[model samples]
Target: MNPTHDWSTTPVTTNLVRGAADLEQTPHGVLPHRLPAWARAQNTDGQLAMVESQPSGVRLAFRTGATTVELDVLPTKRDYVGAPPRPDGVYELLVDGRPARRATATGGNTLTIDMLAGTAETTPGPADTLRFEGLPDRVKDIEIWLPHNETTELGALRTDAPVEPVPGPGRKVWLHHGSSISHGSDAAGPTTTWPALAASRGGVDLVNLGLGGSALLDPFTARTMRDTPADLISVKLGINIVNSDLMRLRAFTPAVHGFLDTIREGHPTAPLLVVSSILCPIHEDTPGPCAPDFSEVSSGRILFRAMGDPAERAAGKLTLNVIREELARIVIQRAARDPHLFYLDGRELYGEADFAKLPLPDQLHPDAAAHHRIGERFAELAFGPGGPLAP
Candidate 1:
């Protein structure tokens, strides 16, 4: 036993005291400690919104029941129309790894906790935190069906002693921003978000501001980024801008500059990475609204100004290819003065090679496996030692 370590069974408000205390926490307790699953634009201001759980892997609050355990779930924010066919309410439940009573919730503004003496029913209006009272205390792990995202702290229950903090190196926030890909699109669980997976793999905390369908280099977004706290940061840009078809080369260049300038305002010296868009065959040089064609499964093409179509081929619109080229140039230009700045093509995370093999089930969002692959690659590339994660 190392002397510096606290090996005592006695009470300590701080972390455990063990020998040779060279290690504080293992990389287990990744940061952005709590997870905030979704953000929504109610009217204009994007506010944090919560929703019902998915069909599986819900992050739930657990307590021992004499014969049953209680469960609580939060809904997804910005529940887009493209979401999986699962209903927007509680549909099922399980206890002590055994099937229990099931229930459902009617559509309402608020979601909540419920009581299931023996059966689980999906009713409505219990709102935030399910208390599973009167269950046999033999249940060890309680699992629920939901996409558990946006958690900060995890606490232990039914004990006199305080719940120990999850072990990990102290919080090292990984600030990331991107499109639907980053928003856990079609991903299995909350922890499957690329940012979340990478954070866990790299042993860092995370601050994920990945918005679905909202990465269009908007002035407001840049301003929001500028104001946010980012110790280690990366921005995945381009695809959305291309698909949005909102600007021309004249405006695009200035827009990119403005966005970077804004982010720099807050994190002047942090390790900042600028990413170009990933390969989307249709959207590479094509422009967008990238809407659903509803005509064909593979009709996910970029919408752009066309010679024949009065809407397209307008001013100086640049495609993802154009942006990727310019982003390199911009980094090359500004990074001369800002040595900390770096660039990574989005394809580095998910390139044409991967795309060909794992075409997205939806034209926009990658499937579960793709999300994990991207996360693993990111963890290795950005957070690995001597990598971009180094302070």
Candidate 2:
């Protein structure tokens, strides 16, 4: 706290939060989660719990006359055993719908992860400060978007002037779910994820459920989306399942059906888009359980390779191609009865043409530029005029 400053502290509350579906009160502060308590209760996986709590699309919005604002947050940062150091999460500020400034908070808990061993350890630490100064001296709507990949416990908000929750802009909410790529993997920052970008370009509120390594068409996730209020919905499927070798083609179709079934229970009339997997050349025809190719780790490079035998495709093992075909077929069949349902070939967002120009740097997730490209394309295809999700 600055001795020269007089600030009013606001308690972290749901009324000030945008883009998150739920908030959990913690000992130090309130932690936002993309999934609600009931949905979280259904899944006991530590990974799922961690990713959902990362607050991928969450932000704080308020109106204030203060020229200076500060936020105190305890961030749970991740560390990898053999990989390069992960970049610090970015906190972006928007004033009156335009980017104002960005800041990064240091001094928080650390979670060390060993990818090969599938182990993790956490060390607690103290909260850090994020301060923004010298804003225009006028009442204005301001938003602070939290880091999409880091789990943050918001401690307090302080502004030199009194602040109040910004009234909802009344934009249609778009709830989305997918794998890491959709979860902002390799994207520049929290607000730069493809979904975030698409939401911005489309002028829609977002509830991103792009759980990294956890988007396996889980029924519980579907139920979460079903219960959340949204005018539009999309579910990107395939990569995680294929890479994990979690199921064969025989099980994939039924799982997709069941996932959609759960969502339709609550949102039968909402426009639901079923999207396939983006192009990953390594997994195009080859099957997966993708494994890390850490041979270049010494050079500060991390890559992945499909470990599943391609020959297993004959045994009904799933691949990107197989999943795409199955998804298209399923959507067509279901659309006959459910006219609100639509199918989007994931390749339409990132396909052969995209790879020729901007490739997936790690044989998997897109780089930051690719994230922008995908976000632009999605906005055009899904939210553009005459598109399936268009108003």
Candidate 3:
């Protein structure tokens, strides 16, 4: 605490959080989760656990007259073995739907992960404080969107003025799940992620489960969606599966069915849009287990290449093309029985033509501009009138 500063301390409660489907109170503090405790317990995979707790779409929304606000957070920052040190996760502050400030929290614990070696080490550090000042000092809606990639434990919140939770606009909640592309990888900022942008344009609240490197058709993830409250839901499948080479078509088809079955258990009638993978030229027609191309790493670049044999497609090895075809078939078959179910070809969002204009820098994840394009396209296709998620 700064003795020179004067502000009233207010404990941030779950009531102030929006976009997180679940919250767990830990000894350190309250941790918001896109996945519930039960779902988290089901998977021992450290990768899935890390990303699910990153608060991808979580934000604190409230109305305040305060000119100054500070939030204390204990962040779990990640470091890779050979890659450049990642920037401290970004916190975006919006005042009355306009970007007011952007900040990064320092002094947090670091987790070193060696993906190739399959190892991780955690080192304890101090909590970081994010401060926002120079507001208009008038009652207005303020939203502080959390970092999309850091696992944050919420701590004390301080404001010079009293705070109240912002009332919802009574819009439907849109729950979405996908791979790193959907997780805002290489995107400009947290709230500017494609899903967040789409949610904003659609006038709906978003709960994003875009787990980077871990969207492996996990049953627990489907069950999490099954339990979460959502008026509209979408699952973006295929890319992660292809990259990991997790399963072939024989297994992939049933996995998709089982995942949808689990979700339908809770949201049978909700507009469940099944979205296929967007174009990744490296794996569009080629099969993968995608491999890191470290040749550019020394030059401060991170790139990926498909490692699987293209000829293996005949053996039913999964590729983006195969998965797209399978997903469309499944959705078409299911739609015959489930009227609310719909299918969206991800290519429609980011396809051959768009790629020509805005290429994926990493040959996998889209850059910030591509995210904007995808978000805008998705908003029109899925959230526009007469669209699957249309009100």
Q: Rank the candidates by TM-score, best first.
A: 2, 3, 1
Better of 1 and 2 by TM-score: 2
- TM-score for each candidate, following the candidate numbering: 0.64, 0.97, 0.95
* Angstrom error at residue 105, model 2: 0.7
The alpha-carbon root-mean-square deviation between model 2 and the true structure, to one decimal in Å, is 1.8
| Minimal lDDT window, size 10, model 1 | 17-26
Candidate 1 residue runs with Cα over 4 Å from true position: 1-84, 87-169, 296-314
In TM-score terms, candidate 3 sits at 0.95
Error of 1 at 132 (Å): 8.8
Backbone clash tally for model 1? 50
As for model 3, its CA RMSD to the true structure in angstroms is 2.2
